[model samples]
Target chain A: MALRNAVAQAAVSVRYVVQRFSLALLVAAAIGVMLIGKADTVLLERARAAALDLAAPLLEALSRPVATINRLIADVEDLANLRAENARLREENARLVTWQSVARRMEVENAELRGLLNFKEGPQATFITARVVGDSGSAFVRSMLLNVGRSGGVTSGQAVVTGEGLIGRITEVGESWARVLLLSDLSFRLPVLVERSREPAILTGDNSQLPRLAMTQSLAGIQVGDRIVTSGHGGSFPVGIPVGVVSSVGEGGVRVKPLGDVLRVEFVRVVDYGITGLVTGPAPPPEVYGPPAPPPRAAATKAR
Target chain B: MGDFLQQLDRWLYAALPGTLVAFLILLTLAPVRLPEVLAVAPLLPLMAVYHFCLFRAEALPAWLLFGLGILFDLLQGGPGTPVGVSALQFLLVRQAILGNQKYLVEVSFTFIWFGYAVLSAVAVALSWCAVSLLMWRFIDPQPAVFQYVVSLFLYPIFGWLIGRGRGRDPLNAPDPRVPGSRP
Candidate 1:
């Protein structure tokens, strides 16, 4: 009985030791992974892409029921608001009829001006419509996974938009999936121009619902309700894509109300404007451009 | 035949709980695009980790916890690329719970919930610190705060589900530390 008790105690001790050793090893491994991941190695990127490719289909399957339920709820809400919605739509249609004639006149005048100026037309943009299959859903990151990827001609750096306005851009692409970094992500930045003053500025995101404008050349004429549009500075996005309107300006600086409702982004248009070459395009001939033009003295004086 | 059957039974008993944990992690990663839910989705897998660590420590080994955490970080891509920040946080939580298992094992539901709230807060704070350190910038803490509150509310629902799956009423189950009370 003494020997048996000794053996049992020994076995228990061995088990305890094994468990403790494994636990320590796992902790070490976790730290090691963190260190390695800090490198942002290509291997990690490939692995992430592969994992996302495999998971996208499953996420699509899981989301269908959720989508259906949401649609049903929306249908009920729509039914309740049907009469009011119809009246609003009628009013909007009447207003749109008047605006349509003005738009036609503007289009004719803009074409005539373009013809007079001998303006060069930009490349036509092609779009790929995709469904959002997955999202990071963490407060720490704002990104969504699309069902279409390389197979669907979706590429990184393409602008993602909805019918409403600019939503974000594709950052990572796999064979069958892509990740879109929303405009509300902390790292997102874009060059924008105010429609009224043509003032250049940077639109920056701080992971809030409303992104803010920064680095404006002049906020002189900028005010609440001013329209903001892409400046096409980087050539990643086309010029004049309406982004948002200046919602508020205060000690906190200018905040924009993004035209896109990111919360309800069911389908998105991934647009490639073929502007990648423009960034790397050769400089215009010296004779055609002559010497560098002098900075506007008025702008410099305003800075002083 | 009896020996083979017993071995299979042992394997199932050991693997089932961990597999369920993995399933919940996968479910959390799925894109259930409920409006505004994405901004503050409850950390369902954290609840699973807390549940298994408190009631069935033997099933939730350290390596399994680490693996789940790594999967979560990878799936939830971030600005600086996710490393093992989540894994470390989970490991810390599991270890803390395991160390205090003696007191925690027999606690009532309210105490367990309170314990979870505290541990989860610690985990989120640690994660925030790790991410901030990784990015070399202080990240906004509002999202983590919102996530914490959402996860707290989700705990009881998940706890009830987990209890139901184990074929025991969470409110009336015998003390799990007792030998015969568990499978």
Candidate 2:
């Protein structure tokens, strides 16, 4: 009996030891994952992709009712504003009649000018529209998962936009889903031009409501309401895609409010410009950028 | 056969807490597009961890918390935090709570909630510090502060639901908050 008691007691001790060991080992494994995250290895990317593929269907199913409810709410709000909207639309329609003839005349003039210059057109951008199944960002990221992926011919670093303007770009793709890193994410940096002033600047997200302008020659050159567009400097994003308008300029920083309401956007277009150049930005945050991040900003700063 | 069926029933009951917490984790990742909803969604799974740690430690173990945290990071599609950051934070928070589990369990409901409010602040601050360190830049503190507020505000609902479940579980000890209750 004593022998049996000793054996049982020993068994319990061993089990306790094993449980403690396993807990410590799992904690170590988690830290190892964080350390290796920046490496952005193929194995890591594949693991993330596999996980994304598994979750996409579940997210897609869950988002449907949410989207429907949102539309219902928006419809109610629209109804509330209908009378005011109708009066405003009528006034806008009368003003648009004056601009319609001017636009037609400019189109003819633009065609003649292009013919005289013998200018070839830029590459036609082909795109696939994807439903945003999840805005998966928590505290650290500002990214959304899309319903299109490898099977849909979606590739990494493609520009994602809505009809209103640029929103962000695809940073990762799985078998049937992709993650777009949003313009308001801290990791996002884009080469953009002030459409009116033509002064070049970099738009960098600080995880705020609006992203700030960086690397501009002069903040004085940028003013409130000046349009921001992709500069096509690195040949990744297509030239002249509207991004946002300068919404503020002061001691706080120059900020651009994205034209598209990226947070609430239901669908986004992933456009393939047929150019596979590096994603435009240096030291692009993390492996989210498919290409290995280049070393610090020395070369990019000099080039600018 | 009766004994075997009883054993199976007991096993299934033991699994319920983890399963419920897992579902809550998945719910947070769902694409709820209400304005500011995603930005300020309460950290639901963490609430589950806190509850289970105090009352039903056998059901949601430390290793389970580690796994759920990693899953949260993956679902978040983390930029600076693809993995491990949250897992480490959960383990740290779990350790802190479990170390004080005896006194915490013996306290009144209000006292328990106060303990949670304090611990959760530390928990959120730990994650903010950890992710900021990983990024090598200080991230905005605004979202984290908002998340903490919503989480605290919603705690009573979450705790009441889970507390009722704890009372119903035959394997669990009596609720300390119940007057005349004894361990």
Candidate 3:
């Protein structure tokens, strides 16, 4: 009986030691993975895409009920404020009607000027509509997964927009799913220009409601309520796409309130302007070195 | 017949933990939006790890915790950000909880809640630090704060669900699998 007890205790000890050792190894491996991921290996990208492809269908099915519930809630809220909304819409519609004539006149004048200047037309953009099936839901990253992918011609770097305004751009695409890096993500940056001044600047996201403007040559003429639009410097996005309006210029710096309501985005249009080729082309091959020199001329010609 | 019955019992026991892990994965993937409340949803998997650590540590082994964290990191962090942050965070939380298992047993629900609060705060802080170091910039802390508050409020609901699955009050019963523990 004492021998059996000793054997049991030994087994338990071994098991405990094994568990602790394995845990330590796992922690080390996790850190190693984080380090390697910073290099952005092709294997990691493919694995992420594959995982997203597998999870997309399940996420779509799971999100349907959520979408339905959200729609129901929105409908109920609309009904509750129907009369006030109707009055507001009527006033806005009347104002829009007056502006319509002015916009028509400007459009005609703009076309005439373009023709006189012999301005070249840009590539016509096509769009693919997609539903948002999931979000990262982490505080560190601002991204959402859409139920569309390469199969739908949604490629990386395509501009994503709602009917309201610019939402973000596609950063990763799987077989049947894509991830949109939102304008509110900390790493997001884009070239933007103020409409009134046409002064160019960088719009940078800091995981906040309002993204800040940076790298402007001068903030002298920039002011609150100025419209911000894509300057299209990198050729990844088309020019003149409305992004947001300057919301505030405080101690925190100038902030732009995005026109698209990212929190309520159910569907978005992935716009392909046919300019991705300029940004992502095949890399040039490394220059091949000639064959190595003959080893040291056999070491003894002079002595011989 | 005896061997078959024993095998079936083993499978059933494994299924309980497997299902919980699968559920946690699905919750992470689900896009349940509550715009008025938060921009980012609460961390459901963190709550699951916390609950199992207190009530069913054997169900959640260290390796499994590590695997779940790795999966989360892969899905959560894109190419722009460093991965494995969540995995390391989860592993540390699991280790800390398991190491304190002795003192944790027989503790009141309030004390357990407080413990979870501290664990979650640590997890959030770790993630923030990891991300800031990786990006070389300090990220906004508002979303992390919101996630912490939301997860804390949502914990009791998950705890109740876990308790129901055990078919007993987790607070009242000591886990039988834990050696030298009493019910």
**What lDDT does each candidate get?**
0.80, 0.81, 0.82
Q: List the residue pairs that clash in candidate 3.
A: none
Rank the models by TM-score, top first: 3, 2, 1
Task: Using DockQ as the measure, name the better of candidate 1 and candidate 2.
Answer: 2
Candidate 3, A76: how far from true, in Å? 4.0
Candidate 2 ranges beyond 4 A from true positions: A1-15, A20-25, A39-43, A73-101, A280-304, B1-9, B163-167, B170-183
Residue pairs with colliding backbones in model 2 are none
Top candidate by lDDT:
3
Candidate 1 positional error at A187, Å: 1.1
Q: Estimate each model's TM-score.
A: 0.83, 0.84, 0.85
Q: What is the lDDT of residue B120 in candidate 3?
A: 91
In order, the interface RMSDs are 2.0, 2.0, 1.8
Tell me the deviation in Å of residue A57 in model 3: 2.0
Candidate 3 per-residue C-alpha lDDT over B55-174 given as tens digits, one digit per residue, 9 for 90 to 100: 778878877788777777677645434568777877888889888888987889889889989999998888888878877877788888998998998888878877776654334555
Displacement of the residue A147 alpha carbon in candidate 3, Å: 1.5
